[model samples]
Target: MSLFARLAFLMLCTVIPAFALASVAVAGSECPAVDANDTQARNSLMYYVCYHQSSPGEPAHTALNPAELPEHIKWTPSQGHELVFSQTRSVYWIRLNIRNNGSERRLWYLNLHYPLLDEVTFWRGDQPEDVLVTGDQHRFGSRLVDYRYFLLPITLNSGETRSITIRIHSSGALNIPLKLETPEEVIAESNHLAVTHGLFYGAILVLAIFNLLLFFSSGTTYYFYNALYMVAMGLFLFAMGGFANQYFWPENPKFANTSIPLTLALCALAMTFFGRSFLEVAAHTRADKTLKAILWICAGFTGLTLAIPYSQAILINTALGLVIIFILSIIAISRWQQGYQPAKWYVLAWAIMAVGALVYAAAAFGYLADFLARESLMQVAIGGQVILLNYAMVQRWRLLNDKLLEVEQKARNDLEYKVHERTAQLRSTMRELENANRKLATLSLNDSLTGLYNRRHMDNILPDLCAEARRTGRPLTIALLDADHFKAVNDTWGHGFGDTWLQLIADILTRHATRPRDTAVRFGGEEFALLLPSTDLEGAQKVCEAVLEEIRTTSVEAPGGAKARLTMSAGIATLLPNENQQEFFERADSALYEAKAQGRNQTVIADT
Candidate 1:
């Protein structure tokens, strides 16, 4: 048989006999009655239980006429403990017959201790339409009584008998512990539970903060992982206890249902990594690989829970949790047996926690009886695990410190040699830094795409070049070249092709300005400038003509296998005596416009 099938078979084998004996009460017995004089809390009061699997939306009290109701025929007698349906998507209806046996009117509170249930609805058999609904699936304000657990007020007039039915449903394990109690009794129980939960949460917060501080001080990554694990565990407990629904997001039903599985999955994921770090299993290659696989599985489950339905998510997460617990326990034991001293405490700590978690899971799946308080049991187990882990960490600290002291003594003897080696390394680093700074300077001055001097570089060198030309009386020519119909080329072919055309133009310009004093500049988009220091206007025009001819002859392939030619317009100006940089550029710019005005793909020279 498969593992799940074998588990189911074992569960059936374990529960069938007990179920038979507990359910062997008088088949036709009416619901148990509560007396007016009874002041104590009644635990596990017997009631009739019926399945509402056929039509989940239909109430259990569907019979219109009072005489049509089949109280003893359809409903089975209770087993005198919490009802356990295991994990299911089915709705269950519980019937309780209450009578105010005494003369005076009686009032009592009905408490359902299972907080994770999605819905709990209460209604009188006579007035089924008038229902009071409350559960984790609904807003907290909708509860019949202002309490975390499902608390409903019941009033019976003197000498009156009323049949009450509760419809319950959940996506998780369904285990309902019913109790009839007085107001004082319910308040006392709530207070006690509140204090216990407060301490548990408070300890989790304190420990998480403490571990975070340790991580910061010691620079240990495992301490940070442990802190995350503790926080996730605390949140999972909060969700399981229904405090997330009650106190956190009271109005969001989706979040309330999602938090339980989501938090548990996250907790498991954190535990997986924390275990890897705590055990330092990397030295054992096989164990490290196994933990890596487990970590991925946990992560997958965490993500899957967010997208799947609550019913499937909870079932999968619970099963995954069991598997993880088993795997961690085995690894811890194996490491301990391998003479890893620190793993000794981990083995014992996780064993207690694994056993506690197993018992709780078994009870959830109906494989074990709900005799013990499962939540409290797991909390105690976690508390014990935390204490043991604290001691283990202390031992780890001492071990590391001892190693550090020995290393320090050896390091002192080699300090002088190490310092000389570091000095050599520093000199090499300074040389690399100088090279990097020179490269950065080159990058800042050049156009990124065209690999030519940019406008900023042109601005910096033009004034000095013009002053030298004026002092020596040797002519300096400035030529501006703009691609003809550049926008039309971009619109026709695309911007990518346009960028390639600009790079081709830049290459042509670089070829003509090959002399030591000649500089090529890509002033802006689709525009090129050549600064010729010892050349007059005529020499500059010949350079522009050569560039234009090369570009015109060159053919580029467009998107549709068509060859397209390139064309440009150029304007040349020779430095006039006493001409400023701006005037010199503007005269060239005007000549470039004149070239465009006369006709594109031609060069024009300014008046001397």
Candidate 2:
């Protein structure tokens, strides 16, 4: 075509390629370079991450290839060790453009500290053979290293730069902490964790066994619950610490993955029952019902963790755990406020444990960064709780023993004094017996709810009143009152409100029956009887109308902020000479029916 045209085309191509390479080099400068002689591990290396929306059935490797990954995603760089994605289904691709600054070949371990990830694929450069796939979702044997953490061994040549990419996906919290460590560092870290975890789980086991024995010997339910709590907490921490999959069920990936939430749920359930019993929650009526409800919810949640997805289950379990902690704290504080001495220790112990648990949960959900011994903080808190609870148990036993001794001493003193004061003691006993008989008689003669004369009182008093009216030749009348729409009130406003309505009616009857010879009686449900002595039917009717008028004007509280008025139907009957008490009651009841049939809220006198 032409010499100048060809030359310009070649120059343009060369300049454009160089400019692109320079841009990449500037971006790569942000990444950290590893030196073989470095003594410390590198956790805060600059890395670029991108997320891929993958379908459910897609394989992790095929979801996004490293070569074709950046078509739609822009690589975002994150500084420090804040690699937290809370419980996601999307695949994350993390790229580290690292250079080996040393002059000699060096081998390093890329450790992913979180082992609960479902799938993790790490590779150096673009080669498929360099990829190593391992996570808790796979068999433990598939991991390159035999450690609890996912450790991949990588070799770097002297003065070489390579791009390391990691693909991670999980059905749990994706709070991955990645580190580049030398073999010595890995060994040291592993040894430190082993010693700490050994002590942690070992303490839990010992406490469980000791409390179990105590439960068998003493038959105390709190001890049994505490033992179960210890066992469940130990298993849960074991699973969460990645030891369960490594040592217990290496080949059973599903069980290993499920164990974390399952054991945690069981731990929560056990703690709920233990708190209820240890705190003596049943002593408080509302708190007792609340804890009972929590027990049922915890049990159902524990079973639900088995069937639901791990992400959702773990979230719900954390929330349930927090709720239990709050409820127990409230009960413990309430007991302490009421001067229950042992509740002080429970409050202190649970406070420490709750703080630790909240911090641990925050760290796990990526709210807090890892600090010194942060992972083991919960274990320490639980250990403190166990010791404090055991101390409380001992103190309670001593208190009980002291009370028993006091009771024995009092009994001996009473025996010694019995002979010296026999006459006075007998007189006091007689007085006490009389007082108890009076109280029992009052209770039998009165309605428990309304505190008015009951049907039994009516049966005893009506015959005497009729006989007296006949002897004295005084006009005696009885009024039977029934509440209008009483059943409808009960059905609409609940039985408790209906009870209140009955009490209100009883009060009106009481106000009208103020005379010495007048009596107010709760005959049955929603029906009241009033006996007026030395009064004619006219006087009884006037009293009844006044009572109905007061009831109609009195405001009864209804639902929805509206006020309601009450009404009643009353029938009056006057005793006749030679009429029996049964005949008098029947006539009064018939008159009441007549009043109700003639529309309620009015009084009708019986025909003599």
Candidate 3:
């Protein structure tokens, strides 16, 4: 079965489950200390984990005013526990107290750590009306600081207690780990995180190069697949780490949000193939079929990520990805049981990656909470897994090289038949490509509606047609045709009937301008043109009369079954000596205006 089909079946058979830790709360006793002269300037504000949920229905925050919050709102001491809630539309309320007991009042910045939250609103001081709002969903300008994480700075007075209330909500996982930081601490930590992410990407790049070198040296498809897997994982990691938004494209949040599924599908595609190759599943009928289906599905999914909403795509991708990883792990372990040594490493690598992915996915889905679960845990797991997989590929290459040498010692044999078969395949592909190109070239020149030369092709051939008239000394006739009362028909019967009327005129022009050197063009909108290389104004007028007669005889039904007859007015001009194509065409256009002025459905020959 296809991976999509299998996933649908699995989803149908099993209930979608959510994981969430039980709420821990102690009323009105949690506070974090602030000192001006502290050597370590950053503190985890792990206290006052009070929550008032909304929409999904929990108690609303009673304490909008900081001065009287202690009396009205029950504050829950977090006991250094992480502030986590599952993916909810409900606005969560969290409160914390900061006391600066030092001689000097100091300013501190508070960062919520999670970057993907949809909204973060902070209330500080005695003012009930002041709220600082910032989040990924908000414009970048809304944040007090120019950072990816939600950050707001607050001032602490000496020997004074300050109450802080934060309201946060998201369409994604709500894992809030707020930190109190001095200016230096925030800068130092940001730098540290940047270095860590840089190392992560650098490792991926080096590993990709290492595997590609192995491929070049060993000439094995194994190395190729290994390199591809690392590259895809690298892309996924860059987007997941928020580096894509931070450095590459800060302004485009939609692209940043959409990049998740794009990279996820890429990594998923690589994993499906790499696992299949490592397990040698193609030799097994049923196992190979599953792997192939997974490969195809992941490829299709990567393309679909562009058109679908990011939230829906991310949810579907995360769920299906977990299922695929589980299946691959099972396959690897099964192969190891069958005595495949490479499968042993495959299982180990898959385990590390699977655990990390599960942790990240859990946090993303609102089942898991903690900064470790959301960030560092998965990065460590992926870093370790990439190393293990690289080692595994090297081992495979080593064994393969040994086998190759042993085989070489026995004999070297090849056949002309294999070359012949490959050559025949190449020939067939080439022939098909040539035919397709020819068809495309023709389609590019011709108008789809009228099968006449479009303006683009006419522009290309106009100079040549002008040159031909000059060289042959033939009276080259240029006619610009317009459907009479075209706009009136459009107004009466709508655009569909208008198109029919234009097509009827196009057909009449095609039949009348049928000389070997003549060309018919649907120049633009309702305007048609004819180029007759050897026809004078008199001869062109005859052709124009014929077109007029055809239009008079022909009739088409409008939308409401009204008989619609379309007539045409045209201006015919023979090429003038020493005049360019533009000048000649303009003179013809002037004549067309004169024809419209004289009467409806008549030809006016140019006197210029």
Candidate 4:
């Protein structure tokens, strides 16, 4: 070839890469070596990280598949910190490589430390079928690992290198904080965080109880509002730290998005209530009126969150929060100057919270370093605020005790002491009775053996259900199911094994009727009934078949290492127009009999 031709080819090669981008692929060389023997868990993922950004919307995510990534895409090192992105409508794809250089298979835990990313998807390049998709926009249970954050299990065989691709999209600023750790390290961190959270919540509970007790003793609603304020702040702290996702409302992702708005509103209201009561807003009408107005506006903004977009709701909440804090600070300082002893503590607590919220917001907006935005930092400030407020209440309690001591009237003190003791006894006895009543109520409505709703509960609910179906004109279907070959099994493996077989059937029934309106009842021994609200004949049949299929696939282990496949025969009937409760029940029951007569372990639909 001529020298001119060779030079032209070289220039073309270099120029093409700039336009057709491809991020550095995760390969054997790219996967950094780790000291497996070191047995330490830490932020060990930065060195193996590379990232590419795509334009906003679903198309960007779809366009940047691992195979279709632009050849000229540039990748930069993470440098021991998260890749922080400004708040914009963009899709960020992160890549990491791991190679198992060991002689045996190994598993590592991967955690994407940020919790608020709207969507996150993880793809294991080598395992085509095992892509994991989860994010805040999805239910908490949808995550592969049930941790609060985006955690996943990564496994590799000896000499195997796997590339992991993560796609994240959000309107909020993005922080790509990834960590790879051993199983022990993961467990250790989990336990430590759990313990710390337990202490935090426990402290809040104690403060609430103390304030509540003070309210009861003094007959002052001031303490009552303070207790409520404490509770609200506790919830806000938990919501911030993703503990609410971990424990309370995991399946409700839509509600999770609303939590911050609702929490801010509730906390603002509680603060307003406590402040107003303590300052006697009726007496200080002018100063307190603006506070009340701001609180109401916060409430209005919170309600808008239900209909409006999350970003707008968040902005409204933040603005109201800042305004409320500023006004409250001024009021608290003013009250302290007027010699209100508790106001001093309130002022201090308010200042700390303001700082926390500011830092937290800055981090969220990408103004501060990503490392400083851990929800635990916010929790610490909240905890401190709660402690300071409680300390002020403790002082009040001490003063009250001293005043009682000063008025040393023996008979009055004796009477008061007796009343307090008797009150405690009554409270304890009432609590015990309430607990017993709850258990008794549950027992009355539930089957003793199967833990499903009893036939009596089904009878109670069916009439109302039929009436509702008539009103709404929505189809309501009922399925009556029974286990097949019951007597032969009882004779073969005794009653105990037969009981196990029945329990297995009950489990399958329970799985299908999971909705709040759906009811699974233990009609009788080895007989079950499912009430599918708003379900048509076809849907009811599908549910019954799913349950039956699950039972058929499951093996019941009998005594002495013997196992048998469990099966159920189900019959479905949709409620007809003008059908009474009895007619509906009878129709379903007739279908069940027909199913038994036709063939066992099969589902049959009632003739219209």
Top-TM-score candidate index:
1
* TM-score (C-alpha, index-matched) for candidate 1: 0.62
Q: How do these models rank on TM-score, best leading?
A: 1, 2, 4, 3
Alpha-carbon RMSD, each predicted model: 21.8, 18.4, 25.1, 31.0
TM-score of candidate 3 versus the correct structure, residues matched by position: 0.58
Candidate 2, residues 86-168: lDDT per residue as tens digits?
44556777766556778888888877787678888888866667888888779999888898888988788888877777888
lDDT of 1 at 60: 37
Error of 3 at 123 (Å): 3.5
lDDT of 1 by residue, 225-304 (tens): 88998899899878877788888998898888898889889888888888888887866588888889888888888888
Over 4 Å off in model 4, which ranges? 1-42, 57-64, 281-284, 370-373, 396-608
**Model 1 score (lDDT):** 0.76
lDDT of 3 at 573: 90
TM-score of each: 0.62, 0.60, 0.58, 0.58
- Looking at model 2, the pairs that clash are none
In TM-score terms, candidate 2 sits at 0.60
